[model samples]
Target: MTSININKEKFGQLIHKEKPVLVDFWAPWCGYCRRIGTAYEKISEEYSDILIAGKVNIDEEPQ
Candidate 1:
């Protein structure tokens, strides 16, 4: 399963889910964040059956 694109508007709803949620808070321009992109994708799919994997782009969703 693909990771959900999370934003502030949807964050509240995602957190209230019965299932566990894993959120990756990142920024596009961060070098370290880019390094883990593939690994995160793999993990998202691996655990998708039990929990929801979400990615929040800090640049776009910074509060």
Candidate 2:
């Protein structure tokens, strides 16, 4: 239901899971990223049972 905040360390494992996954790659300074982030969160809650939703802050973990 809740979105997971991930970094380079957790990305591979999370993406490899059996369930469907949605990952939002964004940076703090981007307005468009923030706008979509709200929508992403809502969708995550709505489809929590069917998929895994996560986010990665590109600025923090460029790798």
Candidate 3:
């Protein structure tokens, strides 16, 4: 699996490139993050052309 760090501007480029992108806006303490993890993984595997399936830790990013 490949990973890259990106912000909103890059995310816009991703959309224009026809890359199927999934952004998981999550924090470590969020219970929903755990629940959605499996679903996100399944999506990544299901789509072959997705360029980005990114996990954004809001806890770490500058606001």
Candidate 4:
């Protein structure tokens, strides 16, 4: 299975439909967030069975 993007509006749908979700809360301007995103993406691909990662931009949405 592949990972999908889940946002605030889709939170309920995702929670009900997918198992073992990994949410990445981040801002575009944050360097650390970018680094972590890269790492997460790599891991997401490597272990597709155990994780489903999605990125969230905190600046544009309500948290």
Candidate 3 C-alpha lDDT tens digits along 5-59: 4576666677776676777788889899879878877776666465577766778
Q: lDDT of all predictions, in order shown?
A: 0.91, 0.88, 0.69, 0.72
Residue pairs in collision within model 3: none
- Rate residue 26 of model 1 by lDDT: 93
Q: How close is candidate 2 to the true structure, as a TM-score?
A: 0.89
**Per-residue lDDT value at 39 in model 3:** 80
Q: How many angstroms is residue 60 displaced in model 2 relative to the true structure, after the best TM-score fit?
A: 0.6
Candidate 1 Cα errors over 4 Å, as ranges:
none
- lDDT tens readout by residue for model 4, 1-63: 444566788766666655576788788899998787767888778877766667677887656
Residue pairs clashing, model 1: none
Best-performing candidate as measured by lDDT: 1
lDDT of 2 by residue, 1-63 (tens): 789998876888887888888889899999999888889999999999999999989899888
Could you give the candidate ranking by TM-score, starting with the highest? 1, 2, 4, 3
- Model 4 deviation from native, Cα RMSD in Å: 2.0
Please give, for residues 1-63, the per-residue lDDT of candidate 1 as tens digits.
979899987889988999898999999899998899889999999988999999999989987
